[model samples]
Target: MLPLLLLLPLLWGGSLQEYPGYKLQIPELVTVQEGLCVIVFCEFFYPWHVSFTTDQLCIYWYWTGDNTYSNRLVATNCQNLVVKTETQGRFHLLGDPKTNNCSLSIRDARKSDTGIYEFRVWGQYVQYSYRTQLNLQVTDLTEKADIHILEPLQSGSPTNLTCSLPGSCDGGRPLTFSWMGDALNMLDPSTLQSSVLTLTPRPQDHGTYLTCQVKRRWPQVTTERTIRLNVSYPPQMLGSSCSWEAEGVHCSCFAQAWPAPFLHWWIGDRLVEGNSSDASFSVTSSSIGPWTKSSLSLSMELTSVLRLCCEAWNDHGNQSVTVLLLPGKSASRAEVALGALGGAGTMALLSLCLCLTFFFIVKARRKQAAERPGGMDDEDPVMGTVTWSCRQKPWPESTPAQQSHSGDTPPSREEQDVHYASLSFHGMKPQKSKDEEATSTTEYTEIKTSK
Candidate 1:
């Protein structure tokens, strides 16, 4: 960059003042940095015939005080002050007197040097004093712009960032504003001398450094200010899907959020174990984005169902997705449906057997009632009722009586083998009481044989 002092003429040409008779012109305003050099651009004219040799022409520059000129001589063409005094190293008159250029340059300007300065012309025994006030502010380059955020910044939302220059530094000379880092443009973002940058920041823009610069030609000042943006965003799915990894059944979940989202995995109804051999997993984190993404994979047994789930969350919000490899399948699900059906079938079979047994018992009672003598009524027989055809027992005959009574033989073998019983139906009457009925439910018979 060219020195500010060297550009003073070209930089502030439009503002240089001119006069009538002699036409002494110089920059109307100028400022020099402390410990730096500055130039007061000067040009003057006279009638061509009314020229003076170098000896007859003399040029002197003086510092007029802020309130009044104290005759403080800054530099003169006199060989002594130009080579001997403090002006030897600090001040110079670069413009030649014979050439009618009386530009004065100062080095190492100080705050006390802030005020008006003028050129004293001496030519052909005629001296002219053209007084012009140029306030020189010698300040360090440490002045910085103030950065302010108009509102809280949110991810995917527009925000206004204002860089206000020092209130004391605003000059009629428009201060050029610029941006250096983390911006879409280097030019001023606003119409004013300061800038108001409006942009919609993303989660990726958090912690991004933004630098603003303000430079003024007349003041010869440059100030830079930096600020970091903080952007907040909600958790969201990065890839929005999951699948088995190359090596094992691992699922990776991706999310974007501020302050990094917390992550966990769920399979079936149980929380998944991390970093274990049989379907264990792990979580990795990085600062590439504001959000966090987690991946979980469990080694599934051959009989294991292929359902996976992942949850990504933070203070703002949480999101989850379940990945199902096979339809209607999950880890550790029981076959309850098949078992329920089998139970129902077994109960039905037992009910059928009970019904058959009841039918057989009822049929047997009906048959016994039909076979009974005395021809029972068609009405349902009483369960304890009994009927018999034979009456009481018969008396035995004497041996001699049996031979005379016409017995061809004593008895046949079959007759001898026959058994006799004496039974009385009258004595065996039906009992209606519960105890007697229970006892009589079985049939009873009496028999006597020869033996």
Candidate 2:
């Protein structure tokens, strides 16, 4: 009897939960997935020394949506106690009263099952009621994770992505995240995604799809997010050139790349004017294997001496080609002007000398005719020279003066030029006005001088 009396106190007494004399052993939080089962561990203390039996004791489990700690009846062993229709078969008694356990079991849990669950004991135990509460959360796993990244991913650079369960599941089991379905092997294994995934992208990896799967065994919930990658790579050299136009220079560069690259024309270090950093310039693109063939063009003002370059760039790198056009002209206009002037002056002087010779011969002819036959008026002529007008002709340049055949005697009249003039000229003359015979000789009086 003494031993029984002492053990009775140990049956239900010392407690840190609920009222000072009562104690309860229930986890403060519990989590489970919808259509799954959840067990809440529970044990409570009562005044065993007073008196109690299976028939005299009763246990009740109540739930409340209000966080204010008010009780709403759900399931109970008390006679005529009301149980919510929704929690009918869902709530079960997984514990026995003989072991002082008030644990509750819930099967086929739903999202609406989240709330504060409390335990109540009634019957003969010297108390009005003994109670304690635990928060329970139920999840359905309907929402998917979010993925964010640069629209067009850059190659050779690290990119980060994240995937996590929403905040709705209060006390769910530990979640794990993993990568799947990346045949290119571009995803970094060292970089995991409990909520985060990081990787260095490559050009060849463009159009690859990656999946992030999250799993939680407590509720057996699994969620996933799939992402398609568009990797950007710098331009690869195909061809480039800078050629001269009539009034300007035309430059072009062709390359192969992913995520089409930007191209521009440069003269030394400066970007070409009128052809700037905008898409206003010409561009042609075609899809190849894993890349795009892009061609770009720019036109800028021409310079006497030109050093031109064409450059192409993208997220990854850049390529360039240079062309140099040295300074100088193929032919000069100054020399043509000098040759034309010299030809005009020589023809003018030759005409002046011919007029003087004709005047002297006419005077001599009057004397001979007067001395021979018919009459004539004898007169001395004035020195006023009559300059004959001559039309411009398409003539070739003059040849060197012919040497005096018999140096002592005067040359024949048809021998051409009578005297020399100090005419200064240089270079070949301009072409004639038309394609006529420019070298035709002119007629002059023949002179036979008696030796």
Candidate 3:
């Protein structure tokens, strides 16, 4: 772009300062941002009889004063005149004094350079300094770089972005351009240092920041502009997962795209939307930035297997994934049957063991009774006592003989021998009373005889 200094003379006429034999025209005031450039439009006139040639005429622009020794000589046309070290290259005498134009150009302006400036002209025997002074004001830079996108960024599509400062010129201080932000990491490193950058955007770059920074080399001033990229892309499936929990099937889906896609689920042939439920399945969905996620749960009895489909879409395109979910009831039934068989087998085994224990106990009791001697009374455990009794045999033969002859005779009675015995048993010894003997003695034995 052309510098603003080239157009100053055509746009604005300078203030006129005239005298008896000399006239000068230059702007009364000029303002510029720091690290920028400006031009002072000037014109001067003299009587046509005052002759001068191009070789003899010289122009000088000074800072603050007209004396070359006291003031800073910033720009001059004299071959031997040396400009100030600070403004040597940046200050230039753009207008020719032979044509009566004393215009001045200043570049890479600094705040310290703000002051009044005077213009002067010299010839073989003539020298003059204009009474009209030019006021130059250099203020803090408050301008920023402009960013222009050639086209809307799309995933996998190449595009260009240009950065330029409003008042910058190629003739002024050389500017350094740089791009920054998360989105720039995906671009070529060589392309990041130029005023124009070319890049192919991706879905990951959407909503990320891109910054254009402009740096002026002389003053080291930096200005930047940041923009968020709205990269459009088709829906991309990030992940899908499913699980069985609490006799139900739960599934989740994740996807990314521009314009925040809408999410839907298809259970078998039924379609489900956000927070919507049917007789068989329920769905919940949410969208944040360019990513959309959804969850689905099936609570119905599944006697047959079904397919769960998760789909996402937007203005760009669509993406979907399907997963097969086996019937929940089928697995549960098999597990339940195995558990029932195990429980019944355990109960049967317990009953058999109890029966065997009871039979063994009864047989042991019978064997103990059979082993005891006849007519011997065993002591009762609860009472701790024993009793024994004996009786004689009856006369069987006499009774049969008497049955034939003793119809009229009265029967006679006869006594038979009978014996009785007693025994005592104690599980523990008892203390003797004071009246009892010290030595242990048998207390009693009862016996009876009958014939």
TM-score of each: 0.37, 0.36, 0.49
lDDT of 1 by residue, 189-219 (tens): 4533447777677655678887888775645
CA lDDT of each prediction against the hidden true structure: 0.53, 0.54, 0.66
RMSD of each: 36.3, 30.5, 36.5
Candidate 2, residues 1-451: lDDT per residue as tens digits?
7565444434543543345456778888898766556777788886563344445567887787766366677777665777888788667776666677777877766778889876766654434344457888986656675666634467767777667655433233467787765633654565655566666776556788978887766557788888887776666545444433333334444555565655555554456432334433444444555433434343443233344454555556655444443333222346434543655565566657657866787787666656753332322222111111112222223433434344456666756534432211122121111111111111111110110
Query: For candidate 3, lDDT tens digit of each residue in 409-442?
Result: 6544532221222222222232211111111111
Query: TM-score of predicted model 2?
Result: 0.36
Please report the candidate that would top lDDT against the real structure.
Answer: 3
TM-score of 1: 0.37
Can you tell me which runs of candidate 1 are displaced by over 4 Å?
1-138, 167-174, 180-194, 240-248, 269-293, 300-307, 327-451
* Candidates 1 and 2, the one with greater lDDT: 2
Candidate 1: residue 261 Cα off by (Å): 1.9
**For residue 340, what is the lDDT in candidate 1?**
36
Superposed by TM-score, candidate 1 places the C-alpha of residue 401 at a distance from the truth, in angstroms, of: 98
Q: lDDT of candidate 1?
A: 0.53
